[model samples]
Target: MSTSYDCSQPEPRREGLAAASGAVRAGQLVVFPTDTVYGIGCDAFSSEAVRALLAAKGRGASMPASVLVGSWHTIDGLVSSVPQAARDLIEAFWPGGLSLVLPHAPSLSWELGDTRGTVMLRMPLHPVALELLREVGPMAQSSANRSGSPPATSMEQARTQLGEAVPVYLDGGPSGDPVPSTIVDLTAVEPRILREGAVTAAQITEALGHDVPVAG
Candidate 1:
């Protein structure tokens, strides 16, 4: 059976974090709140867990999930190198609504999908998510809804879509308007906006002190 927690209360928040952490470590899926929307997550380094997460969402390996970190420093270990523009962006919009896609360190033994030697990373600005991430290290996460469905903006919506597939649900209330994080691809010579959401292209250009192109 699956379990759900009302994270508004102190006791439940603590308990929920614990349960969510346990589930992730066990290679099980857990639903948690993020600044943009609810996300289904599991241990990032666990290939089995990653496969399960993709399967639960009815998604394929080609469209891989992104990894969520608890802090900015976590990026250093994940990627091969951090470009100056990436550092500027991380300083300007990290822990908020920006996702950076950079080349992963060749030494790391984890697989997210057909990432093509790259990984998308973000540090969400949510207490429950940050707390759980800090406890569980990095996690492979994606919007808490099946493929081609609307993203879940509340615990109920996530549960309704994911159902028993997710073992633990952390209820952090509604996510308000679903503005996803802006995605910046740092793999190329010049940074480009793969998808604009909560953060705008102008803002990213301002952050980098240059005009960054936005892909259609």
Candidate 2:
């Protein structure tokens, strides 16, 4: 069975972080709170860990995992291009509820499922997640639930669904947003919304000062 920690306590917060980061570096899965919902994540650089993450969710490679970075510097280190449109979006609503798909760098040797030549990235706002991300570097994470099931907004729900498959569960209580992030693909010729959630279409349009197209 996995250990669960309440992040509100200072001592447990430190202990939880140590356990979670260790699991990540060891290529193991851990559950933590995010801005949207609870997420299951591991070191994105570890293909084996990513496979385990997908398997734990009962998902296949066709569904790609999103990358969570601690900062913009981490994003720059992993990816090649951040178009003006992406920069605008990042500046307006980053470290919050937006997931941007940018061009992946050739030098990078890690994979995030069937991500193609692009990677979906975000800097989560939750302190527990941000702290873990800062410690673990880039992590490939997805909603903490079985595939085709509702995401776990609470740590209790996540534990029930995921069980001991994940070694560490950082209990940050309920996440900020019950909904997922708005996914925008900047690698496309025009910015496209892969999925609409926390960030509205109108807000994205206004943020970019132009018309943003929608694909889904």
Q: Residues 1-216, candidate 1, lDDT per residue (tens digit)? A: 899999999999999999999999999999999999999999999999999999999989999989999999999999999999999999999899999999999999997999999999999999999999999999999999999999999999999998999999999999999999999999989999999999999999999889998998
lDDT: worst 10-residue window of model 1: 207-216
Clashing pairs in 2: none
Best-performing candidate as measured by lDDT: 1
| Candidate 1 local Cα displacement, residue 24, angstroms | 0.8
Cα displacement (Å) at residue 40, model 2: 0.3
- Candidate 1: segments with Cα more than 4 A from true spot: none
Provide TM-scores for the models.
0.99, 0.97
